[model samples]
Target chain A: MATQDKSSIFADIDEGEVDQEDENVDRWRRNLRLWRETLAKQWRMLTDDLMVRLAMITIAFFMIVAVFAPFIAPRGPLTRQYEGDAGIIIADWVEPSFLSSESEYLLGTTAEGFDIFSQLVYGSRAALLVGLVAAVFTAGIGTLVGLTAGYYGGKIDDTLMRIVDFLYGMPLLPTVIILVALMGPSLWNILFAIIVLQWRSTARVIRSQALSLRERPFVKAAQVAGASDWHIISRHLAPNVLPLSFLYGAFAIAWAILAEAGVSFIGLGDPNTVSWGTMLQSSRAYSALDFGAWWWFIPPGICIGLVVISGFLIGRGYEEITNPELR
Target chain B: MSDTGAPDVSDENPLLRVEGLQKHFQINEGLISSLLRATMGKEADYVHAVDGVSFELERGETLGLAGESGCGKTTTGMSLVKLHEPTDGRIEFRGMDLTESDDEELDEFRQNAQMIFQDPFESLNPRMTVYDTLAEPLRIHDIENETARIRRALEFAELQPPDHYFDQYPHELSGGQRQRVAIARALVLDPDFIVADEPVSMLDVSLRAGVLSLMERMTEEFNLSVVYISHDLSLLRHMCDRLAIMYMGEIVEKGATEDIIENPQHPYTRSLINAVPVPDPDVGRERVELAGEVGDAIDVPSGCRFHGRCSEYIGDICETDSPSLEQKAEFDDDREVSCHLYDSCGKQS
Candidate 1:
């Protein structure tokens, strides 16, 4: 079990964990032990939950496909359908291999001759990339802003919170549509569009938390200890709010994945990308759904729904973690 | 002024001298209120959390501030450390006026003063280890020898084999152990004074004595001035050399601990001592049940704040005229009381 490997050689417990005394390896080792115990407790909570297990299994499956796309895919995402006599046809809709035994095509092909199976396999990469990157940046920015607003309060709080309110007042899809339109359509642009608007929820939730946390006696003790404002925010206040940050980060992954699909379905996706959104958009060219080409369209649609729902289920599991019941 | 009549052994320079310390929090805090007050001439309101309290301490003296909760005892302690900026008053530290002290002097004051908060569970950061909590103060003050200093503080706090606790988080330790870490952190900077706001009240009763004695030992070894704030009269009587009884953001009485506990002069003080529960069930005692709750601190009583609940409410004078803190010829030379019963109050009117 992962819990048993407390001393795992590659146990990187934190990204910016303070060593306190970098020279004291014993201190580091003890901290590692402490970190493992805490992580194990959280792991138990996650594993014990049925919804969380389903979410994990689904996400794990997508992750495997995403990570091994190059090795697993039999053809490139944008490869043309090459017929026996007329090779490399761009406008031919090939039949699905299951429909005909001798047909070379697997899960058929688009009018653009792009293989549906290859594109679906590689599409997981786009979904996870946008989901993970957007979630990270969203949580990171929100946490910093929340800490500053909550710690310094008064005018800074008013100003920052007003900005957040303004962003929230903006309609999400429409604003993201405008943002993607203005920034030019690409996978990263779509990711950026999601991030620009999505950080608001994390910021609001974390800001309210930071508001209460700053009033905690520990934060005041740090102040009485002669620590600077930045030091207190980073070392004391930020760490306390991190669990809440992670919870929001999980919800944001679900939001971002769904949003990317929405933007791409509106024909604003990266033309070169093989995301489920782009696959769905391209399926419309041959009216594959009207012609009942469920193989060409339904697989990508199901992948999108499964991944997004799994993200939400995992996010629900993490909510229990942030405000865990007394053990 | 030494309101508690604590002997001034170091008379030339008392460690701390506070005069008319007041901390009032404005209740209506918003743009709408400001607009109303500006355009419509509406009056602003305040909580009057700590109003016009004053005292002085010699180096190494332990002053106990005893009052019912919300009587501003904790606010008084917090003001001592500049945790809540005084609304209107002067706090002098070693002859330096804190209200007007520049950043450099304030920083010096911050280094010299520390506070151990009430709840150990809430006082120590959960994310930080014991070693990190202790090292934070030292690091902030630019002190060296981080490891040795942390070990010594743990030892001082009576945590045996201090190294064992070096990496333990707050949640992992018992309540008593967490309070010890808090004490260790407060004293790590070697500050001249510390404000302990009910430090052990949240601990198990069995653990309170051990933590209190640890603080006492820290005081003697370091010659530290401490302001112990608690509503527990017995605990204060045990820990404080001098005691000040607060009533509605004002010090109604203060004297040597024995005098306040034994020869309480103010009617309010007398009632407070009488309220302490006796352990012996066989012993019958006459209890003075206070007629009403503590008066509203915002719209404070016009006369003596305690007159509304005073057991010996003396006629119209008690209702109309405010009394100043004065020494009666009858009470101990060290004692002072702010009550209408004192003949000195008659002279003032």
Candidate 2:
């Protein structure tokens, strides 16, 4: 019996060593294996997942165009090209002529003689930047506030929730526009305005979720184990609330981008930067409909619509994963 | 407040001494109710979940708190560990007044005292792996060698080859395994005391005996004091050294488990013992069924709380005043009963 036990223990030790070796095998190969597994899981999840597929395709297209805008656009956004029709030098407000052999202006030209296609391509970078950055900051602040409020619910919760309610009651768009106007319409200033107005909704949603989770027995067990409040909130509460926050983040991005576009439409946009909103704003100056330059207005509008729709699709896709009951 | 005629405290004081423990929870009033109460100059209602319960536990003792649903047995167990702070009471652990301890002292107390919940599945964090759950208490107490502690705890819980279960999530393990993991988590800290609230009630019938025997072995091996709360008296008789029968929010009878079972004094305890089903078909047994639903905790009876459904009612005194716990002469072992039949408070006296 003693010999049998010794042999069994040796076998177990050997098995442990084999497992350790398996874990430490070439770092790059391990990373590659991890990446392969993650991709396979994502692929399986995306099978028949129309919303995720559509969102991925839309965002990927926008990202590619934004990254390689200079190569993709027929001409520079600020470049001037003078092509005379019957020696008249018709340079500005050029109409869409797909069959014209003079130049490759597939979409046309803006009122300032800038290629409209180039403006549309470059516009994606600003829109995506504001949307992604604002949403991330908003979600970060909101999650912190929500976790603190929900976990230590009493005077702290009441104070924080009242502040949230106050922010929620404010007329969001006008307040943001006023703030942006005062700040001189810089990109960072607009991003800050979006975050301030947007975080209340995220805080409210995450607080409700955290409130329900606070009473679970695991939390009570942690309390009994003498775990500090900070440990409980960060280690236990945050991970459970993160998936829902991702869903909230996706929606917040769409709203932020739209808010930026609205600000630009009202002529409060940053003058130095070119965005999809600015392109649309410049079209209004040319009396686009009367001038028959449909190309100038249509491309930016379609881009904004597709991007916002993709945001909703991504948000819903995450919602389905986080809340399986919804699926 | 220094002394309220409780049992004398001496150098030989038990590991835990609870005296006049009372926990009343106020029923939260809505806006309209509060306004009306303010206008009427009336106080809000309260549910006396644990009202004036007291007991003493020696080192390495296993005390079973047995009662039916809503009898406050669970509440008593919880109050002992300060899970539910007592509205009025004194809990002395190791001769120090736990009720007056500061935050740091209470944290130290939490390290010494731990609790196991009724539902194993709900007690564990579904997202945490078995190793993580077991390591948490050790981490909290700053115990060294966490890996060894976790492995030993897994072995104590009979989850052999701890590595097989180290990374398994709660959802992947069977109900019995999850419950074992919960047990291992409590055992990992090597606490001096544990309050297991219906630990085996949620498990399958086949798994219960194994878990209970494991708990029994652990208690002996670790010299751990334990309060086992359950509605099942048969289980108590099997495991407890002493048994306290709870009715409403008070202990009606308490004594050596065998003495209490062989000769029950209080009517409530008698009925509780009778309610336990007998396995033998040929053996005849008497059944005592009390009438009426459990009365509201907010409006407890003025006199003996059990008199409304008690089988042995002496007279008007049983309806006017309650009886205090006193020694009875019928049993050879020391047994205390709180019934007018066993006391001199009845009208016949």
Candidate 3:
């Protein structure tokens, strides 16, 4: 009976199979160890979250579309189509249909007989361009201003912060609209309006952080070492404040996009450019809603919502890193 | 212009001499009061953090500034290095008058005289790697060949396998290790003098010895003149060649460490030595209970700051007149005592 039990155990444990299985297990363990080490080295709370990952992916999708808009779009955003040589529109406000063939238009057609899918693909480029450029300009100016004010302190700090407060207190959207109107509805004008309004929050956050950081011993040590004021600000102070500015920059990008969309919706957007907001304006102007053409307005609205939401989600992810208490 | 009363023993000039060093911080008044004072053109109330403290440090000598918590030792040390910018004082370093020096001269003084702070964690920048922290002074001084200098500093600080510590940030290092990095930063510039303000007070008791020993080794290696400030008299006795005891911003006693430890003249110095805990069970020690809390620096006593808490309080003179430090011939070394008891005797003789 003992011999029989031993033989059965041996049959189950097959010697060659066990050896192969052990080697596989060792390789698996080694890979897991490598993954864990990499995670430990580069892990950040903001980027590690599943919600943030989804947000980043959404952002990446919009960015890809924006970048490849000219190639991916089937028709020119402004191109109009006609039924025959007489130029009578046949696909005006056609509903989206997957069953339609190439000539029927995949996302149907707008009231202007322009392809809706093409308009969307082209619109992302404008939205992302304005948002990113405005954010970069605001971050640069705000960081320089805040670093100077906080590091020098006393009168400089008081004067700059008071100016920031003045700007912060103004009605953001209305001011932006007024500025955009006065400057004329060009891309740079709209960007300027957004940047002027968005920089206050960045300056305020960076200034407060710089004020405390200036008191740290390392700064004092640098001073004792006779490092010049400019050197201290550019090297020591700037690097510390950059991470925080980046966190604020993410939020600022979302704000810029929303501001641009709002201005465009109110008819201040550049007429030459195609954007989600401009698409909405055109859809409304042509009475697409009254005509029950959901494809004309709904798609643009959804794209704006998706882009803004994704920007906010990415900003939130950065927030967990900058303000670690939230994690 | 009161005489410091120290007998001039040596003709050779000291490396650094501080005379009448005073640091007074203005206490903020209420908004209404400030307006009123501004209109009246009156000066605000001030806290005399370090008031009329004077001492000299010779080359290659470690002078320990021993005192209680609020005795202004740290202030004295910081002001000596021009860190706090002495409110009023004459700091002469290596024959250069620091107070009268131009920006360039002051910068030159700063390069030669560096300070090591108390808290190791706070002293080193959290964002900086060990390499950057060590290289900052070298870079600020505009020294060439930074890479080789940083490596030498790492080894000099006794952080073996210097590469391991070069990339590590302050937070990654242990307290002892961080303090060692701070020491390395001080040494990298090869400064002739260092003001170490309670360098090991924030460290664990077990770690203090190692850090202190490393500092001692550096002192020998670098020929550094250090003003080592600490409340621990035992540590001071172990480290310092000469000891200066401060009381309420005033140096009450100054002499060789062994001479002062063996024969404490001033009542405050005697009390300080008595306060140090003795480990022997067979030997009984008299505990000198320092009376009341140290009074507010803003409201220092009229005569002597230690009079209120003194064990050997003399007569009405002790309360009426402040005593100036005087050299006594009774002791073998050039021991200076500032108690009314000794000063009155010296005056009579």
By TM-score, the best candidate is 1
lDDT of 3 at B80: 82
Highest lDDT against the true fold, candidate: 1
Candidate 3 chain A worst ten-residue window by lDDT: A1-10
Residues A1-327 of candidate 1 have per-residue lDDT tens digits of 111212211122222244545443355576688789878978998878898899899999999999999998889998775654455545557788989888777888787777888999999999999999988999999988888888888889999999999999998888988999999999999898888898888888888888898889998898887789989888998878888888888888888888898889889999988899888887886687787778888999999899989888888888887766732
Q: Which candidate is the best by DockQ?
A: 1
For B203-273, candidate 2 gives per-residue lDDT tens digits of: 99999989889889878877788999999889989889999999889999999999899888798888888
Worst 10 residues of 1 chain A by lDDT: A1-10
The DockQ-derived docking category for candidate 3 is incorrect
lDDT by residue for model 2 over A179-204, one digit each (tens)? 99898888788889989988998899
Using DockQ, rank the candidates from best to worst: 1, 2, 3
**What tens-digit string does per-residue lDDT give for candidate 3 at A165-194?**
999888888998899889999777988888
CA shift of B199, model 3, Å:
1.5
How do the candidates rank by lDDT, highest first? 1, 2, 3
- Judging by DockQ, tell me the better candidate of 1 and 2: 1
Chain B TM-score of candidate 2 stands at 0.94
lDDT of 1 by residue, B1-349 (tens): 2222222322466889988899998875678768878798766778988888988887789999988889999889888988888999889987778899888778777877999999999999998889889888777777555676677778888999999998788999999999999998887776778999999889999998899899988888777899999999999999889999998999999889998897788988888888899899987766777888988877878888888888899888888998787676566466778887876623220
Q: For each candidate, what is the lDDT? A: 0.83, 0.81, 0.80
Chain B only, TM-score of each candidate: 0.93, 0.94, 0.92
Give the TM-score ranking, best first: 1, 2, 3
